[model samples]
Structures are given as C-alpha cells and as structure tokens.
Target chain A: MPHDHHDHPHALLPPEPALRVKALETILCDKGLIDPAALEEIIDTYQNKIGPQNGARVVAKAWMDPDFKRALLQDATEVVRDLGYYGRQGEHMVVVENTAEQHNMVVCTLCSCYPWPLLGIPPGWYKSDAYRARAVREPRKVLAEFGVTLPPDTSVRVWDSTAEVRYLVLPMRPEGTEGWTEDQLVALVSRDSMIGTGLALAAASVIEGVEASNQSVEGTAE
Target chain B: MSRVHDMGGRFGDGAVLPEPQDGPVFATEWHARALAVTLACGSLGQWNIDTSRHARERLSPKDYSRFSYYEKWISALADLLVETGVLTLEDLEQAAERAKDQAGGSEEIQKSHPLSSRRLLPEQVAAVLAKGGPADRQEGPVARFQPGQKVRTRRLSDSALVNGGHTRLPNYAAGAVGHIERYHGNHVLPDSAAHGLGEAPEPLYAVRFAASELWAHPEHPGDQVVLDLWQSYLLPEEVA
Candidate 1:
C-alpha cells in the first residue's frame, strides 16, 4: 500500500515519507491509523505523480536527439533545463558519458549523491552499504550482477559526487534507433538507461511491438 | 563512529586497533531531537557537505553500516554543530515547527534558503572555484618513476584512516608492483584528509596493470587496468 514503486528501507531521509512520518508522529502519533494514511497519500502523490517518469522522459529525448545528447554531455544542467527538470539538488549536474574505453559509474561513497532532477529519489539499494562499499572497490563485479559486464581491462572509474557537483550517467545510445523518429526513439528510453544498466527499451524487438501500440494513439489523435 | 571500510590499517604500514560504537542515533530523546533538527535543516539544502577524495579518518565501520549516507552527513553535521555550540536541541525543534509551517500553504516549496541573511552573489560560486584553484593537484615523484621503472603499492595499515583498516590508500592496486603509465595532475586533498585527517592537495599518479596482473584471465591477457593513485600510496622500486 506504499505509494512508491518499491518499498526501499533507505528512502532519502527527508522531504517525502520520512518527513511525513516525522510530522505525523509529532502531530498524530496518538491517532496512528489516520496519520499513517495521510503519510502514505503524500508519498504516493510524489512517487506516482512526479518522480521517475519525469526522469524517463529526459532519457528518451536524449536517446533520440544528437543535439540534446551533446548538450547533456557538455552541460547536463542546461540540457535538462531544455526539458524543464530544474530544482534544488538537481540545480547543478554533469552527465558523464559511458564509453567503450571508459565506463562511468556513480556512487556517493559519502552519501547518495544522485541526479534527483533527472532520476528522482535514489532507490534503497543505492544507499545500502553493500552498494556503497562494493561500488568503489569492485565496480565491474557489482555491475555484472546487474547484467552489465564490462570488457576486462576497460578502465572503470567510479565517481563519488557531492551536493556541489552531482552526476548523471549517460548510457550509450542503443542499437536499432536507426530510422526511428525522435518521438519513437523516446519511447525506447527508460529510467534504467540513466543508471548504466539495462539497454534502452527499444533495443529489444519486443519494445518495437509496443511502438506500434503507441503509434495507434498518435493515429487516433490525428 | 567509524565506517567499516576505513581499513587503512591493514594494507599500509600501520598498527591496527579496536574502535567502539557510540549509540543508536534515533533511540534516545536528546539524540532523536538532534536527528530531527539535522533532517529539517538538511532538507532545505542550505549548506554543502561532501567527503569524497580526502585523506581523513572515517567513522567506525559498524557505525557506518548502521546509518544511510545522508544520515551520516546529517549526524556528522549535527555532531559538529553541537560540539561547537552553533545550535541547541531546543532551537532545532522550534526550527522544525517553523519549517513545517512554511512548507504548508505555499504553492511552490523552496527546498533551500540562504544560510545567512546576506546571500552570496552570483560571482561567489565562481570566486570560490577560482580561489580553490584547480580541482586536481600537481604531479609528484611517481612522475620520476617512468613506464618501465618498478614501483609497489606501499602497505599503509593505519586503523584510524578511513580507507586504512583493511587497505587504505588504493585498495585493489595495493602491494602490487606496476609500471608507471602516465602522471595525472594533483587533486584537492583526498577525502580522508578533508574530513579531518591527512595532508591537503595530494599529488596523484596513474599506472598500467595487465589484465593478467589484476585478474588472471588468459583469454584477456592483453587487457590493461590503468589506475590513478595518490603519490603517498606508492613506494619506489629502490625503496622496496
């Protein structure tokens, strides 16, 4: 019944459920049932209404447009601005490009330094000690668990970002976007692309079929 | 309060010592109040704090696993404030109430406020950067060690150092001898120091390791692992 897609234990400590919990516990701890529901409602509104889906749209656009991609690599803050994702923690950002020679992975070895503007709140796993410790020590091994196996010998540099300078991962543009329109390409991008895992959704022929379903919506509108 | 991975003691030439935990952060009354204050003030994103590449001691490992990263920052910040008497627990509760009120009934909730009434001007961020100079520090001795010159990862086993307990300095490349590949510029002090430990603006170096050197993969023996390491972490071949 939690509003978020996943019930992560290490939810960012403030601004959503944590804040709601603190507020409710203070004002409505005695009225437990009523307080919890309100807290849940607040969390759900943010998660479903205004979180990762917003990030997914940016990922999709970058995949389809070269100019946007260039803008993203050169200056993520400006590029994300074009898409309209600007705010607090996301105020400054640099999208690190993942290349064949070098792979860029993000970790806030200090804390969870995330691209909240582009990716929403970080998941529980990101804040876990396991991810934090292993990320800097054995990046390739940990990545393999996510099904991303880097070629042995590719210099995997793990970046530990802070609030002053945050980072977003720009997964390589997937194959099969060729001949696809910008709108179609956007459909192929997903939140995972921004995290350096799972290829763009369109790379799978199965996703191409879903593309047809999307086309129908456009067809009906026309 | 120590981070688990601050195993700077084992790898480098240093002694190991036992570290103790303090207490459950949220379990007690005074502690909970402090936690609440940190959460509220931190939510606003008013101040900047990060300990990435410094050479300072970190909290005990057990303490680290106990709290989330931001929780750690909040704890560190609050503890520093309380230690310095910047704010009191009573002030925190009052502030939280005020923050909650501002948050409600406001169409646009601003997560940040100026830490001080006198806000920094636009040029301040740039000025800070210019004053801080380059993020990367200058090159050092390893530059003296060429591609073919021999070098070994020095064993720095200082239990107090964050990355020192098991193997501080560079974890993977420790104790391994590799030829110098290139000299990277020096960077601002490593996290260990910045957090409150070692020297500042430490020089860094990059060395190349064969795939077989790091991992014995005959199939990919030709592969190479080029790593950027701080100069203090390395010892010249002549010394070893």
Candidate 2:
C-alpha cells in the first residue's frame, strides 16, 4: 500500500535494472558470496578468450589433418580438451559432420544449452523463439531464413541438445579449398556454419572478402 | 506437457531474424552481471544445474513471458538464493532500497567475510572455466537401447507430464517414433536431479526422429530431429 492513488492505478515498480543487479552484486560481494574479481574474470573469459574462433580452429584442423579429424569425430570432448578448448556448457561434446549426403544442425528448443567453450555465447538468432520453436519442426524453413538452401535429396539432420551433451556441427569444407593451410581454412568457417544454420563460406567468398578488404585499404590510401 | 517454457514446435512466436555478424557476448551491463552472478552463485553448490533450471522453469507464466532472457536469469538467481537459504527476501529488499538513490555503488562498502571454498576466486576462474562441470557419471545400469535401434518416446501419463519439476524431454517428441543414432553413455537425469531425487545416472542416446514423425504433413520432407533422450524416455518400437 505504498502508492495507490485513484488516478495512478499501477503498483510501485522496483529500481532500475543496473541498480537492481548492482544491488544484488553489492549484497553478494558484501557477504563474500561472490568474488568481484571473479565476476570480471568470467566476463573477460567468455567475452575475449572463448568464442567461435576456437571452434574454427577445430574445424580447420579437421579439414587439414585427417588424424585430428578422426579424433574429433570419435571423441570430441577429450580431443577438444586436449586442444585447450574445453569448459562450461561444453563438458560433453558431440560433433556431427556435415556431408554431401546429409546436413547437420544443432538447436536446444527447451533452453539455450550451447557449446559455450567453443562457440562463446549463442547468437541472438540461434536463441530466438522462432529458431527454437521451428528449427526442430521446420528445419529447412528455418535454414532458409538463414539463407541456406540444401538440395532436396540431401537429408538434413538437426541435433537438439536435450541433455548434457552439447553439439558442434562440422560444416563441410567448401570446394576449391585445396592445399589450403589450417589458418587459411579457419578464415572460411563462420559461427553459423558450426551451428548448422549456415554453411561455411566458399573459398571464392573468403578470397573475395580478402580482396574486398584490400581494395578498401587501397581506396583509403588513395 | 503444456509448460510455458517448453515451447518447441508450437507456433506464432515470430520470425527468426538474423543478428549482425559477431554480436557482443552481452548486450548490457545487467546482462553480464546476470550471467556471471548466476554462474557464480551456482558454484556455491547449493543447487545443481537442473535445480537452478527448475527455479527458472517454475517461474510464473506471466513473469516468464514478461522477463527478458537475462531478466529471467536474475529472477531465477534470487529464487535460487532464497529457496536454498543463501539469502532472505528482506536482505534483497534492503539491498534494493539502499541502492535506489545511489548513482553507482562504490567499492568502499564493507561487509567483508572469509570466502568459502564454494565461492569462485578470481585466480581460480581460468582453471574452473577450462575444467567445466562434467555431468557424465560412471556406467549406471546396463544400456537398454543401442545405436540404430528403432524406438518410440514414452508417453508420460498426464499427471507425470504436468507434475512439472524439471525434465529434458521436449513436449514435441512425446510418443513419436525415432531411431537411436548414437549412445552418449550414462549422464545425470534432470527429472530426478531437479527434484532432489539424486543424479540417477541413466544411459542417454541420440534418437533421430524424422520431422514428419514429429509433425503432420511436415514442412520439410526429409529433415530429421535428433534429440539426446534418456533411456527411460524411450521404448522399443514394436514391429507392426
């Protein structure tokens, strides 16, 4: 009954968001319930140290090194951990490869259970209501939304991360990437490709992207 | 079965729009704090991930829709803390009240106490992050279903469906037929764990259901939905 005027019918609202979190963090820190520096460490870890690049490195190595690919496909968790790309939300890794015969995609319809250690935080689209609700039911339609259209004959397999096991889609290396170094192949791997919502960039597109950037640099110099 | 948060194939939410390439890990300060604090609090081991998830799942349907993603996380954090006796409502209220007028909280405020082993330290963060929480346990019961075996999802009784503790089984796949694609070994069953029934490790398998089996007159012809389902959620697909 703090505020209940006839004209203003709404209940009193809580403090602003930043203040609310600040209040919670303030209390928690005050009680030694949480370490402030640990909070900063987590933010830095996910924001900087971990991300799609780690996954790209894995995929690129798979594309270049057969033995590494075999290990990743066989025991992703140990293989990924050995490569130093293992952590929370990524404890149990199941990497499904995309092939000419079948395309693989990953989604968590009930909640956002993603591979945090490799892919960082999920992109908004992957976590969207549309993607979660429709991806399992109408995957091709969802893929079309992401601008990926597979041939009719190619089977599409969508992995729903319903348990502790997290999935990473090993998108097929695009054609014309022959004799490419692991570093060069890494440049072609998009985050969506690893999520199965999109395909890896074609070799031509990566070359074009490089050329386009160079052109921009030259234009700026002029 | 009709839980507000168990939205899998149900429609009318909206279209899936694309985010610009390489978005920020967190969009706001509150978001980062929400994520960090939730994880930090969970590190205290007061509750398991499933229990924390249940705290979020059992949120009022109205509030579930009203709250944003991180908002839900913060709300769940409060619920978890209060439910686990880590903090009182009065403590939360007093903190909010004291923070309302302040432009920004200062570091000088002292409520210093010795940190527990459960509390994550700054230096331990890296090793902790690298060494993630592994839910996989030693082999429990013998595996029932094997890879490539035809199986159908168990149709939970209406009571079990609505009991609503916490479950990894998505509503859309109930009673649907699929084939076991791979064996993921024994892992914690969230249904039991979330309700304090213990880890109750169970053999898990990736069951691949054709999208057509999940939906009628399917939108996509050959697409398949592979779900990591516990052995308990499955039954042998009896030959017709």
Candidate 3:
C-alpha cells in the first residue's frame, strides 16, 4: 500500500503546499525543463484572456441574437471558436439549453474536467469531492446549496463531463431585460449561471450586487 | 482502478462550499507557477492531456485527497517529468538541493542546466492553444450503437480493478442501463490513450441515464444524468 501523506503534521498548513510547489518549480526551471516566462504567459492567458466574462459575453450575445443562439445550440465549438474562446479543454463544446420545463447542470465525476476557455478555471467547489459525487446523485440538493431554487415541476438534467467534449449550460434569459444590449445583458450573467448551479441574476438584482460589491470595496479601502 | 478520484455518487465527504463572488484566477503565486509548469511541460508533446490526468489520478488516495488542487498539479508534473525522461531523478534531487541551499544561504547556483530535448517556442504557444487537442479521429471503425439505442455499461471484475489500469469509464456507471442520447463521433479512447496503447479511436456517445435508474433511491424522478461514454464501455442492453 502507498504511504498516506495526509497524516503529516503540516498537511493542513496552506504555506506548505505552496513551498513544495515552489521547490519543484525551481528544480524544473534549474534543469531547463520549464520556462518561467512561458509559464507566466500561460497563466496570463487563463487569468486575463480566458474567463467567465467571455462566456457571459457569449450568453449575452445569444440572448440578443436568435441566429447566434441557434448556431451555438447546433455547433458550439464552431460558434465559440468564431468568438475566439476556443482552446484546451474547450476543443469540443456542447451548449445545453435550459427551458421552462428543464434545467441543466454540469459535473466531472472522475476528475475536474471543465471548459476552461469558456468559464476560465473552475471554482474551487466544482472540484470538491462532495460536489463531484453529489451533483450527479442529488442535483437539486446541490443546486439548492448554490442558492438556485427551481420550480418542483421543472426537471433537472445533470451533465457528467467524462470525456474530451465539454459542456456549458445556456441558462434561460431572465425576465425584465427587454431590448437590452448585449453589453448591458452581460452584467446579469454570472459564472455560476453558466455552470447551471445558479440562474442568471435579475436585471435589478445585478445592479444591487454591483452596488453591494462597490460598497464592500469602499469599506475595505476606508 | 476504482479510486477516490473517480467520485460519482459515493458520498459522506462533506458539503459543497459556495465560491467567492469574484475570486482571483489563482490564489497564490505558486498556484500560478504550478499551472505554468504543467502547461509548459505539457506543450513538450511527450505525453497527452489524458496521460497527464491519469498520472494525477494514479496518486495514492490519501495524497490525492490531501493535496491542494495545484499541489496535485506539481506532484503530477514531477512524476511526468521523470516518466518522460525529460528530467532524471538525480536531476530533480540536485535541483531540490539547490533550492534548499538558496533558502539557507546566498550561494548562487548556476542556471546553466542543459535544456530538455523538446521545447515549444513562445510564438507557438498561442497557435497551439488556439488549435487545441481535438480528440476526433478522421477515420475509425463504424459506431456500434446509434442514438436512441438502449445499452448497458460493461461490468468490470474485481481483478480488473486490482490490475490498476486507467479507464475513462467511471465505476459508478458500470453495468447501468441507459439510452444512447447521441453519437459523438470517433474520438480517441482515454482508457487506451492514457497507457500509450495507441489512440484507439472509437465511437463515443452521450448516454442519458435517468437519476432514478442510476441510483437506488433518487432525489427526484425527473432528474437525468448524461455522460459522454466511449463505445468500448458500453454494450447492447440485450447482450449485456
């Protein structure tokens, strides 16, 4: 049997893992196996370029344009690529649409395989053991934890992404956003909404969220 | 082999925590470096993404659960570096010693180590990222089952688990009956791909299993779980 490292005294310490990573990176760099600058470039791409905002933009555009939505639903890979959010885990894309009678959720039961190009890095909880196990078994309970309460009559569909093909849930467009521009609609879209764990925030709720965040930032600044 | 990493339906871990409204891409610098090293080394073409994932999954269950997400990445990175002959164990040990020495003193270690056999040019990174790894093979055997066909996942024996070969089929879905939602076209099978057993491209499908059918007592009768399953993992329901 393999030794259990979890029993180590420092396993719970956050700095220890970081230190180990630094040590390995230093060694890899010293051995010329990895380029630190290239690593930074990759990080920048994921952090700045590839993210939920891109997916939000896609969702917002889909909401405004019926043709794009149809194209996205028919062939997401081509549509997403045309929009420049095509790479890595997003080579093969499938957009599941949420309707009045059905809702969709995504989970990678085996590992944390996600559409990185669309939603950026998955949130920490998405990779948790509990979510991976429960999302497929008890999706409604999982969605409830995310504060996404659906009507009892609506059926929930859980997508377990077990292959190279990735999925992005096209959440239903919220009400009271008539004639909204794509840019304005982007504010209502959140990363969780795209993952199907939560629904798109209402137009007014989005404003309230922004104001709340701004107030918190000001409080921190003060 | 069945492992904790293959987490589907088994429970008792803990509650899922909510994510921060707006979290940074990476919480710490090391996390970013870990991602970079994984991607940089991955660009070397030594091993594919599926193989890298198997390396991480092959970690002992205790370590798998204990390590932070990035920690798992670094561990797998080190393993792959040695496995691919990009770096020797001695080279890694020497690097570790150098890191330790730098930590304790002002001694400057020479940054003159020989480069790996393969290196991706900075200019190639964007194109490579944009192109991505499309698993679909141009030519392969015809798909065995079509959409709307009823099928059952093949059951694995205990010996199969003991042998410890990597497989894309999750254990929980094994032997369960589901309807073929759609044929996803020919794609490289990860079970064989992870072990250097050739691409072994085969037909894949979106198999839709009702939540009630998958679990003994499902939370909701209306719930459904769709898994992208490889053809090799399934058989005709009548034959199963």
Candidate 4:
C-alpha cells in the first residue's frame, strides 16, 4: 500500500536525531565498530543462504532408513540435531502431521513469525496486512488467492503464533515410491509440501524438474 | 479527510515489497532488504502518533507504508514503547544489548523450552498438535454494551505528524453511532502500548457497525464494518 505522505500527528521529531544517527554510524564505520565482512560471513553461515536443501538431504537419508523415519516422527529436533537447521527465529520447532481428517495452516497475526530454519524466510505476501486481516475472517478465500483449492467441508484452522513453537507441516507420503531410494524420496518432498500447501513430492512419473528450493530446516523425509 | 490515526486509506496503493528470496544478493540479507525502506524512513525523522494514547511514535512513512499489517503492529509497538516511558531510548539500546547477549548465549536465557521443544511427549504435544496449536490469547467483552446496543465510533488520528496535510483515520464515522449487533470474544488488550505495558493476552469484543454508518452506499444498510476493537475504545451509550 502506498504510504500516505500526508501530515500525521506523531511525525513530529526534534530534528537532531537525523543528523545524530548519521554521524554516529559514520564514526562506527570509520572506527570499525561493525565489520561488514563479519556480517556477510555470519549470514552466509546461518541465514537464508543455507536451509531446506540441507534438510532435503537429511530427508533422503531417512527414506533409505526406517530407523531414521521412526526417529524423525518421534523426535524431529533430536533427529536432525546434527544438521544445525534451527536458527534465530526457529530455535524451537513443531512438526504437524497431515492426516486424512485434518489440515493445518500457519500465520503470525502479530508478525510473520516463521520457522526459517526448515522453511526459508516467508514470502512477502505472508507478511502483508491483507492476509492477516483476511486470513482469520476468510481463510478458504485467502487460500484460493494463493491458487490452492480445498474441499468445501475441509476445515482450515489458521495458527497465529507468538514468538514460540514455530511450526512445519509434515505431509503424508505419496504413492509410487515402492523401490525409491532415500535421495529419490527426498527429491519428492517440496517446500510446499512442508508448508502443507502442496502434496508430498508427487510421483516421478509426473514429476517436473526441481525448479524451486525445497530446503527444510528439520530435514523432511518422504 | 480521515483522522491522523485512522488506517482506512491503506487499501491498494501498489507499495507492497517483493517476496523474500536469496538471489544474486540484494544487500547482504533478506531482512535488511525487507526492512530497508522502513528503516530509511525512520532515519528521515518521519513518524506517527499513537491514536489510542496520543503519544509521539516515530516511524518512517516508507516503513509505515510498505510494512505488512503485523509489521505495522510491531512497528507501532516499538514506536509507542519509545514515545511512552515504558521503554526508554536507552531501554531499546539495552534491549539490543540484551538481544546481542542473548544471541551469543541463548542457552542460559531461555528458562523453559516452549512446548514445541518437547514435542516427543505425546500428551502435551497432542493437545497442541491435535487442536492445530494454541488458540490466540484474547480478552472477553466488558458488558458495557450488548447486542442491539447503540454505540458511537470514536474519532482518532492516524499519526502524530501530518505528512500530506491529511490524516489516515478520517471522521467518516465520527460521532456516527450504530448498534452492537454481533459480539466476538474478548481480545488482547489494546491499551498495552498507551499504558507502556506488555501484552497479557486478555479478552475483548467485536462490535458490528452498519455499512451505511461507515460508508455512503447502502446495500443492506445492515451490511456493516465488523470491528474487533478493544473495550477501551468503546463507551456505553444510552438507549434512544
């Protein structure tokens, strides 16, 4: 939405803050108070630079090993503990299993609180006010806007989180992977699958190229 | 013109930012870009006022404009915290210190893991997972009014400073009264910012206003603007 440049009562400031901040930042830069390189290194090592794809590798490993799947479903945090997928906003995680009876969706009515470790930073639309105000009022309509359709009777429960228990949706495994390997199954679990938006990676017979990134923080397994 | 605090003018102005993605690299990080516009505005000394409390809250017009709804809420909060005495300029400075320290040694800071950390425990996780997670905490109605109750929408400003010589919250429904047709459950306290308090997740009510009361056209005159406003925003009206 275009910001109204019109007069707002609170826009009043002492005028000195603007100049003060610039001079302070300049001095900090000159004195090396903040390291530009260090910030880059930190982001590369922790931020959106690494995610879902690494989790995809873990998911692939699990499909090849039943012991791992059991471990994944039971205690996902421990299961993927070694990968170090959890980050600033996603230190704590919850895996929601999608079954025949129910479906799950997530929202942070307060802000776009996402599980960035598994899923990358949320899309811009997720953070928009239209979604926040409308999602609660009419979720089905909102989902449709995202190009997803659900049965008329399917109840969509939108979870509005508050800096706690970030969520990831675990879709039910798809069919036709009878003799698939771990890597093959991992290839099937798309990012959308984890968001509970799309189904678990569809069968290879109809599978398309891996166009989008599917790196989940928790290491999703088909 | 709308009041400085009203947000009605926030409809499709084509100012929304693009999706967050790790591409050829925009400015080093996604958040930096996501908040770049707003942060720049904040640097410009542009800001708004707390309509609920009439406090001076500084926010950039760009951030104020481009921010998603919840981002606005959070921004408004940070603004109010600075304006009111709840959080001082130094408090945020200290909070940043705390955040930095917490970032380095978070293991000691968190007292108990939120429920998600212990999902292996079937019973507790079952409650959240089965119910699709916790319900939003809210406050219930104060009963100062009831359904079929006549009430007036209050006039409020959208910001502390005027940008275009216009306000965000117009007097469209100023002094215009309507009936409390529907009652949604109580919600989080709206006065948290004004009072310089943290949210307690209380209850509030949703009051409905006839469409005619807020706008010019009349589909049903009954078609209304349903507001999940805090009780503090409403006052008891006498029966006519």
Off by over 4 Å in 2: A1-16, A215-222, B103-117, B157-162
Error of 2 at B124 (Å): 0.7
Clashes of 2: 0
lDDT of 4 by residue, A1-222 (tens): 333222321222112333222222222223232233333343343344545565565556655677876777666665655666654446445555555655555655434567666665466665666654444334455556555676644555444443234666666667777787767777777665565545565675324443222433234643
In order, the B-chain TM-scores come to 0.50, 0.92, 0.90, 0.43
User: What tens digits encode model 2's per-residue C-alpha lDDT throughout B16-110?
Assistant: 99776678878877788878888888778888888878877777777677777776777777767766777766667667666775754454544
CAPRI category for model 2: medium
lDDT ranking of the models: 2, 3, 1, 4
TM-score of chain A of each: 0.71, 0.89, 0.88, 0.70
TM-score of 2: 0.93
The TM-scores, one per candidate, come to 0.51, 0.93, 0.91, 0.47
lDDT of 4 at B103: 46
Q: Of the pair 1 and 3, which is ahead by TM-score? A: 3
Please name the candidate that would achieve the greatest lDDT relative to the true structure.
2
Ordered list by TM-score, greatest first: 2, 3, 1, 4
Docking class for model 4 is: incorrect
Q: What is the C-alpha lDDT profile of model 1 across B127-150, one tens digit per residue?
A: 322222124435323244555666
Better of 1 and 2 by lDDT: 2
For this target, which candidate reaches the highest TM-score against the unseen true structure? 2
Residue pairs with backbone atoms closer than 3 Å in model 2 (clashes): none
